[model samples]
Each structure stands twice: as structure tokens, then as C-alpha cells.
Target: MGGNKVAIVTGGARGIGRGCALALAEKGLDIAIVDMLEPEMARTVGEITALGRVARWYVADVADHARAAVVVGQVAADFGRIDVLVNNAGRGNPKGILEITEEEFDRTIAVNLKSCFNFIQPVVPVMRAGGGGRIVSMSSLNAHSGGVTSAVSKFSYAAAKAGIIGLTRALAKELGPEIAINCVCPGVIETELGNSLTKARGPELMKGIALGRLGTPRDVAGLVAFLATVEPNFITGQDFIIDGFQWVV
Candidate 1:
């Protein structure tokens, strides 16, 4: 299993995942996109291909454990090696504790938190077999701030993102020397999923941010690409906050 570097980016159909995938491809890594959005995924694959890199899309839910294993196997078989795994697939939960159902809470955890475990377990072995690799998971500033009052993601989403931090720390120890793992916590980023919140709070939110503006998918993608491609990496288990210093949240 040997070729150019390869990366698997979950939720790579659009938004932040798309940015990460394109950034990695620009860094000369083949991209394997995992997402449920067919048209968007196809568009992203074409974009990566246009960058002169191999690009493939896998249709699967990130929260499915068995499916994650299957997809990882297929990626290894198709790409011949796994160099990076970006766990970026997640959904926001706007419901409060009082209104959310038990199933809804569980699904939020499964999709946002447990899904990391599902992919990491299978990808870790493949990465180890490939000699060594890097893992950058997408957490959120909500993990630290508990989100603002007008935020679209609330308690359940924050909890899941926080779990990603814990998982990154623990796995850094468990998979160390063979694999380097880290997570990133981005503040209010302007993406399709996040536009509603941004449109409503853009001006108000910018006032609190040191940068005096909201963030973009490329803003987060740059950090992820750095963590993935940084040579002789000495960093792991750390959560890099790319929030432009938003003091309000």
C-alpha cells in the first residue's frame, strides 16, 4: 500500500469539509471524500481532480460504525495508503434540553462525537500500517464557550464537540509515536449550514471578534492543512481555536 499521500475527509461535500479537502489536495494529497450529499460530493471530486490529484467520493453516513469500517477498507484498497483523516462531519442541534427527545440527543452524540470513534478505530490500524499519519478532527468553539444565546447549536452540539476534544487527547496517547492526532475549534464560520446564524448575528458577532469579521471555511481549512502537512510534527492532542479571538463567546 504505497503511493502519494492520501486523506479522507468526512462531510467533504460542501462547506468546511470541502475547503479542507481542496486544501489538502493542493498540498499534493489524493482525496477521498465521505459524505451523503451526492451532487455536492461530485462537484468537490471534480474540483479536486482539476487540481491534478486523485479524488473519489464515498456515500455513507459518518455516524454508521459498520459503514465507516467498510468505507475505510475501500479507501485503503483504492488509494493504497492513508496519510490523513479529517473528521469534519457534524450537524447542529438547535433544541434545548427541555425540548429535545432522547433519540435526538443520542443521534447528535452519534453523529458529532461517536462518529469520530467509528472512523478512527478503523483508520488507525491502516495509518499505523502505512508507517504513520496525522488526524485532525473538527470540533467547535462551542465546546469551550457552551455557545451564545442566539447560537444555532446548543447543549447537545456542544457536548458532542467537547467529547471530540477528550477523544483527541486520549487517542493522542493511545496512538502516539505511530500517529499524531489533534482537533480544531472554530468560532462562527460563514458556511451554508451556518449562514442563518451569520446573517442574523454577523454585525453583532464581528464587534466581539478581534478580527472584526466572521470566519470562512478556508479560515478553518488552513489550520487543518497545516496540521495535516506539517513535517516532523511535534504537536498532538491540542485543540487549536481558529475563532479570531471572539471574546463574547
Candidate 2:
């Protein structure tokens, strides 16, 4: 609120999304949380306010382009400008291709991939008008490996995550010298959902990580904060892997 820079964090209610919002707020940026979880969104807003940043939440599914456009426009107007966009909104698709229903597959693509396109379309115009901006979207280690075992999705999730990387690369080429766009494929973070996924495989997971530990949301958030706030932005079209060298690809 007090700062001039403003950032919009999708899925900013919890998990890595909340981490990214708080990190940006810590760096003195106003926050606009685009998420459907109203209660969690309020909690995240409180944290941002505690850090002395202006914060607001818009309840809507990010995959809906029309609704997403309205919120993005409102944020630009309310903050007077949009400095960064973090497309961290996504859901884990647990079923493999053959096991997943058609509806489930569609939902996964809508939330994990199409949502990026939805918000980016509206925000780009605002960023271009403002002269520059930063975009950091969340992909996953699944993008590289397709997934570890029969537990995680082998096709849908991996495809969606890979799409984010491809989308980021193309956007960087189009928005370069102005807006910097990048994606990160994080592996086994300690968020509630992440912990649940790894509960049975903690020891096995740790063995895969060269650092002997899984990543934290803060680790991923720190990179996003840097991409948004750092100057002379030469870094774009990159897919950063924050998995402690587990799925190094």
C-alpha cells in the first residue's frame, strides 16, 4: 500500500502462492491476490498488511479469462500500475493419462495451463503501457520427468507444467527488453499439499535430492522476488529448477 510497485499473485491464498505474495510484500510491493479461496485469501491479506503492504483479494477462478481479465484490470487501476505478475495458480493432477477421466483432464489443463494465458493476456497490455514488468509462473519437477512413480500424473500434469515453460519462453521473446518472463519447476516443497504428497516417501524423496532435503516455498519465492525487483532484467525465457538437484533437468 505504501510502496509504488504492485504485484498480482494468483492462488495467493496458500501454499507457494502465499509464499510468493508475502515475499513480494517484504520487498515493499503492494499485493493483489487472485484466488478462489476466500478465507485463506483473507489470511494472506492479513500477513501482507502486517508487512506494511497494501493488499486485496479477488475471488475467482484464474482459468476463466473473462473473470480474470476483470480482476487484472481492477488491480491495475487500484494500484495505478502493475509491476509484476506471478502465475502460481495450479492444481496437482494425480491420475495418469489412461486412468484420468476426460473431465478431469480438462479441469487440469484449465487450472494449470490456460489460467496462465488468461491473466497474461490482460496484464501484458498494462505492463507494456507502464514500460516494463516481470512474470514468474510455477511449473513443477513433473515437467521434466513426467513424474516419479505411479502415484503422480505421468501425462496430464507433466504436459501442463511443460506448457508453462514453453509459454514463458515465447512470451519472453515477444515481451523482451521490457517484460521479463520466466517459469520455475519446483520439486517437493514443504507446503501442506506437498507434505501430504510426500508423507509416505519422505526418506525416498530426500535421497533423490542432492541437498538431502526438499525445497521450501520460500526458496521458490525468493527467486520470484528477485525476478520482479531486480534491475536491468537480462534474465528471461528461463525455467529455473528449485529441486535441490533431484530432477536436475
Candidate 3:
């Protein structure tokens, strides 16, 4: 469906980002991954290549504005064009209001929120030049629920994720008709980062989910693939929740 197109997925080394990368690859798009995990990122590139698609990996801290620009430019040059961008790179903060230091809070916002702007600004011109493109950022269910008492992330993470929704909404309007912008809010996806939480609350958590199972990377990936490749798409400026109908978190 996305034949000959190229997608850049941040944090595409593992977990949901990797899932999204593979799913997009399955739809016939080449992938360019940006992440700091060298070995895991290389492994993901190999997997995408095995699917008969061109894939490359770049190591960068997504929070660095200049570095993101350089990486985006490199990807555009290497791939010839940029078609899809998935802002799926982020970190979780388990600290509460008091325990968290100032540096940690700032870093959380930079990594989770500012990184979106960093990537989007550069990619927009590339997408516009090439006709148009689709952008999906990974928000969290935490944004909506404000995180459960036992949740892995606390107020700071929620704030950053919530900021992503606003970013998506504003950018959708500003970049629209040509570039489609959207974000996804996922609940408790069973990724490496979230495994500890899942293991600790496995049974108790499932009861609250309508699907009676923890979400998988594949679960979120499918929705991302659809958003990235859907034809005659009128969908944009929206946040789709892929949480298996969780009434409680």
C-alpha cells in the first residue's frame, strides 16, 4: 500500500516503535529508524530487511534539536523522500512530585514533548516538498487518566504526553490538506519498558481491560499502519485510543 515510500520511526529499536516499523514495512514501505540502542536498532533493521524492504538505523538522542535536524536531513538524503514519521520515542518517570528532581522533570518534558516539535519541524518541509505525508506521535493513556496510583509513570509523564495531543491538534491544522497529523494514546502495552508493571499487576490489570489481556506492540502497530497508509483518508487532528477498552487503569 505504501510501495516505494519511506517511514522514519523514532525509538524504532524495540517495543512498540519496532512493531510499528515492521507493520509499516509489511505494507511495502522502506524504514529509517532513529534510536540510541545500537544493537537493538540494528536487529530491527535486519528484520525489516528480511521482509524485503530497505531499512537503516541512526543513533541519536531524540531530545536534541540539532541532532534531530541532522538525522532527518540524512534520512531524506538517504531515502530520497520522507513519507511517514512516527514520534514513538519516549521514557517513563516512576517518581512522584516530591521524589522527582528538577533535572528529571525537565528531561521528561524534553524527551516526550519537545522531541515531537524537533522532528516535526524538519519533516514538514520534506513532506510538503514531496507532495504530502502522514505523522503519528505516541501519546499515552496516562495523558487521559492521569496515571493510576500504582502506574509506572506519574504526573510529569502525563503532562508531557498530554502536551503531545495539543501538538498534534495544532500541527494538524497548520500542516493540513497536505500532511495528516495525529497521535495515539495506548494503555499498558506489553513492551520491554512496561513489562515490570505488567508482571507485578498481570492478573489485577486484565480484569479492568475489556479485552481481558494486556495490549501488545502488534496491537498498537496495526492501528499505526492503518493511519499511515489509509487511502482517501479524512482522518487527522485527532487522538485515537488503543487501550482495549480499559475502564480502569
Candidate 4:
């Protein structure tokens, strides 16, 4: 909330993650951006620094628990405390059940679900030590409504995202008033990854959205930033869907 408070956003190099990083930075929180993309990560750091907030970048795969621990520890050492953790790094595999291999399924679960645990586990103690914290995980509308794309329509991605909701609830209970954990499930956002998937699926996918247009990363980021900063600390363990009413229709 203050300029001195520190936040970490995983996969903050680009897309939805980048939007969240910028949103938080604009709010005056120093940021630690973790991503596998070195150049892009550095660019995000530069942007945050230009915002007059301290910014640091850590390059590592979110799925690697050991590396995540080290990176988070380094962040704690650098920032003195971590006030918010946004688990925004994830991968979507759009293959039908018959077409999806076990390895691919595992990778999807690892990135989308396990990575949340990897980042949260280390940061929980840091947050508790700092008195309290906020955690926002990136989820997908496909987790509730089935995916329209032929690739992910099989169910693995949805299942993995659903798992994220479960984890958010369980962790929220475990952390109690000390930390708040929540998930944001976005629908058909027009990020580079989203556009690629939409192109892969064709125009019919766009027509299905009640809004008649795809969502954007900023649309989702706005909600994420709100949940992270606004606090009487009552909202926890909830999953907010930003689908432009697509699910309603």
C-alpha cells in the first residue's frame, strides 16, 4: 500500500503478468519481478524503476521449487519484507484427452498449479513475519466453463485451474488473518498467448463471448490490483471471474 511495501509478481516479464506488475508499481509498491525471460524481465524492471519504485528482477522457471526458494529468499533479503505475492506465471496446453500426452498434462499442472505452491510456500513465512500479506493467483474461466478450443477442450487445463482455486481456499484458511489468498479467473483475454489460441480456434470462439469482444490483460490486472491492495482483509479464499459476462450467457 505504501511506497516502502514490496511485492513480487511471477512471470512479470510480459502479458497479464506485466500488466499486474505495472499496476502495482503505479500504486507505489517496490517490486520484485520473477520470470524466465531475461531481456523482458529487465525491461519490466526498468519500467517499474521509472515509476520511482525500487525494482528487481529474478530469472527462473516458476515450476522449479528449489530455484523459487532461492529467488524468493533473495527478494526477502533485498526488499526487507514481501507484502504481496502474485502468482501469474502459467502455461496452457490445448490438446484433447486422446491427443494430450501424460508429460504434457503433468507440465500444465506443474506450471499452472504447482508453481503457485512454490512461490507461496517461501513467501508465507516472510509475509507472516511482516505481520500480513496478500496473494493473488491467475486462474482461467475455462476452469469453470469448458474450453472452446479443440486443444484444451479435453479438460486438463480446467482441472489444473480448478486445483488453483482449491489451493487458494486451503492456504487462505491455513494463513488466516495473517495472509489473504485469492484467485482471479479470466476469460478470453487478448494477450499474445490469448490471441494465438483464438487464432488457432477461429472466429467462432469470439462470437461465443457475450461481450462480443475478447478481454484484455489490463481488464484482469485491474481486478488483481484491487484485491491485492484494498483491505479490511475480509475477502479471502474467493475466486473472482473476469469473463465479461461470457459465463452468464
Candidate 5:
């Protein structure tokens, strides 16, 4: 709401995270971007600063809880308060069950799910201290509909994402009137990750969507921005699906 609210977006260097940072900055929120890629993170920081908002970049792996805590502390020290947190950093594993190594499975779980815990845990106190805050985590349509890959791979991703939704609901209830938490389940988007997956799966994958087109990062970013604002204060503990009605038969 206020023009001066501060927000942190994980993986803010590129793709959906970049889109979200710019969108929020346009709405007048000072941004603190966290990403592992130092150069790209700096680029995003530059873009946010150019928009006349305070933008700081931190290079840290969101999956590392201790490191994430330190990064969050630094953000609070610099910004004075954090009104929003976007857990947008994530990864995908497209390999079939037999092909996916334990290392790959662990990495996906760490990046896609555990990062939420790392980011949210530290920020919760800051938010409560500030009176309230909004948190949005990225889920995926594959979580519900399941992936086309082998059972083990699909199960792992789906389980992690489903865990995100569960976390959102439980945390929303725990925080209650003080903070709002929600999850966004995106369909195939036109990000580098999305493109690669689509190419790997071939054109047949597109046939499932009635809209006949993949989503854009902007499409998902718009929803994230809306949730961050005061207008969505009444909304919490919900999972909003942003696919092109692909699940519709």
C-alpha cells in the first residue's frame, strides 16, 4: 500500500522474479533482491533503482537457512522494515524417475520448497513487528495435475509444491490478522525454463491447454503484485492457479 513499503523478492535476477521486482517497483515499493547470480542480481538492482526506488541486491542461496537469515537481517537493517516477501526462487527436474539421481531430487526440493522456509522464517518476525505483511510463494500446476515424467520425479515435485500450499494455509492461520500468506500455481510460462521444458516435451504438450499458448512471466507477476498490495488484505491461505484453464477438459 503505501508508496514507501519495502519488499524482498528471491531469485529477483531473472525470469518471473525479475518481472515481479519491476512490477512491484512500478507500484512504489523499495526492493531488496536476493539471488545466487551476482551479475544478474546487480542488473536487476540497477533496473529497480532507475525506477526511483531503493533497490539492494544480495547474493545468497535461498535454500541455505543461515545465509538467508543473515541476508534478511541485512535487508531489514537497510530498509528499516519489510512489508512483503515473495518466495519466487525455484528449480525444475524434468528427468524420469529412473534417470533422476538422488542429488537432483534433493536439489529440486531444496530450491523449490526449502527456500520458502528459509525466507519466510526470518521475515515473519519482521512483519509481525511492523504490524503485518504479505507473503506469496510460487507453486506449479504440475503439483496438482502431476507431471508427465516418471512417477518418482513427478511425485517429488508435486509433493514439494503441495507442501508449499499446505505451508501457506497453515502459516496464514498461524499469523492470522497480522499477516497474509498465499501460493500461486503457474502453468507453463514463457520463461527460459518453460521454453526448454516445452521443447523437450515437444508440441504435444501444448495441446492440453485450451488457450493454446504458454503464459508469460508478466502474467504471473501481475498476480504477485496484486497480492502484495493492500487490496488483497482480505485474501489469505488460498492457492490461486494462473494457468490458461489448461486443466479444463
Candidate 6:
């Protein structure tokens, strides 16, 4: 494994993932992107290279633990180390529990929640060997209030996001004193996912955004990059909300 300065960002092909990868690259870290889309992944990699940072891409569905393991190993081999892991790969599920089927729920949980563990497990040893590391996973404000702001996700999505918070808290204690891990819950981000939800919910979702507008991928990405790149944060198991004071629970 490599030393603290390399990063692996999942779902780095587009949107928030891309933004996170770029920001971290700009922060002077070599990046490895794990994503399913080759074209988009290439775009992000190209941007990283232009910024003079080493970039690698792996086309893998992180929801599959087996695939994630193999990919993580490849990343370790390619980068010669692993420092930060940004779990930015997730699916936007707008289906209510009643509207979603069993398969959909299982898949959503795997993609949004379980995938974090899938990579977290294998990457832990790599980071430990390199001394220590930082990890940041993506959550959502919807997890706090059942997505009432958008009404796009009712049960399944909310449950998965809530699960992310639980997972982050539990893991933080176990991995502490060496590795730092945290979660980010952003509200109504201005990304493809947000735009689609906006199409269904209209622009009214901006009603009470404390910042006077929806959050951007870059907005959330900045927070993720900070947690991953900035050291001695002395922070873990915390949920950092990027939403403009939508809810405080």
C-alpha cells in the first residue's frame, strides 16, 4: 500500500463524484476513480491528469463486495498506496417503500449502504499498513426527515441513507486513533440527480434553503475533499450536513 496522499473516489465518473475527485486532485493527491461508466470515468481522469496528478480508473459496481475487493487490490497495486477513500457511489431512488419492489430495495441498499462496507473492509488493512487514512461517505439530508423536502424518496431511500449514518458512527469508533472516517449529508444538490428530482418536484424545493439556493456537487465535494485531504481533523463518526439548514435533527 502507498502512503497518506493518495485517494480513491468511487462514482468518480460524473457529478459530485467527479467534483470530489477533481478537488482532491487539485489539493495535490494522486487519485484512483472507481466507477461503472468508462466514458465519464475517462473524462474525470483526463481532468486529473491535466492538473498534473496521477489518475487511474476502474470500471466496477461497488455494490458487489467481490468486485470491490478486486478493484481495491488493483488500486493498491496501481497507486502503490491508498490514503483516502471517498464513498461517493450511490443510486438516487425516488421510489417509496410501497412503490419499490423487494429487488429494488435490496439493490438500493447494496449500492447506497453496503457498498461502503464492501470497500471499507478491504481498504482498512491497506491504510493501516500505510500508517493511517481518512474516509468520507456520502449521505443525504433526506435521511433525516424522510425526504419531505423533495418527496422523491419515501422509505427505501430514507432507510438506506439512515443506514449510512449508522454505519459511519459504528465504524468511527472501531477505526479511530488511526484512521478518520465521516459522512456528509447534503440537501438538494445541483447535480443530475437533483435536477431529475427537481423535474418531479419542481423548483419549490428551494423554498427554505438557508443558503438561498440548492447545494452543488462541488459544494459537497469541497467538504469531502477537506475531510480526506486535511489531516489532524480529530473528527470521526460525525455527520456533516451540507444542506442550508433545512433541518437540524
Candidate that scores best on lDDT: 1
Assess candidate 2 and give its TM-score to the true structure.
Answer: 0.95
Task: List the global CA lDDT of all models.
Answer: 0.94, 0.87, 0.94, 0.87, 0.87, 0.86
Task: Between candidates 4 and 5, name the one with more favorable TM-score.
Answer: 4
Per-residue accuracy of model 6 over 34-110 as CA lDDT, tens digit each: 99999999988999999999998999998999999999999898878898999989877767756788999998899
Candidate 5: lDDT of 160?
A: 79
Per-residue lDDT over 19-91 for candidate 4, one digit per residue giving the tens place of the 0 to 100 score: 9999999988899999999999999899889998899999889999999999999999988999999999987
Best-to-worst ranking by TM-score: 1, 3, 2, 6, 4, 5
Instruction: Give the per-residue lDDT of model 5 (tens digit) for 9-93.
Output: 9999999999999999999999999999999999989999999999999989988989999999999998899999999998777
On TM-score, the stronger of 5 and 6 is 6
- Using TM-score as the yardstick, the better of models 2 and 4 is 2
Instruction: Mark the regions of model 3 whose C-alpha exceeds 4 Å error after superposition.
Output: 1-3
Q: What does candidate 6 score in Cα RMSD to the true structure?
A: 1.9
Residues 1-249, model 1: lDDT tens digits: 788999999999999999999999999999999999999999999999999999999999999999999999999999999999999999999899899999999999999999999999999989999999999999999999998474578999999999999999999999998899999999988898678787777778889999888889999999999999998789999999998899875
**Each candidate's TM vs. the true structure?**
0.98, 0.95, 0.98, 0.94, 0.92, 0.95
Q: Judge candidate 4 at residue 122 and give its lDDT.
A: 95
Candidate 2 weakest lDDT stretch, 10 residues: 146-155
The segments of candidate 2 whose C-alpha lies over 4 angstroms from its true place after superposition are 1-3, 148-152, 247-249
Q: List the residue pairs that clash in candidate 3.
A: none
lDDT of 3 at 207: 93
Which tens-of-lDDT digit does each residue in 118-173 have in candidate 2? Answer: 99999988988887889999998888887847255557878888999999999899
User: Worst lDDT window (10 residues) for model 3?
Assistant: 145-154
Q: What is the model-wide C-alpha lDDT for candidate 2?
A: 0.87
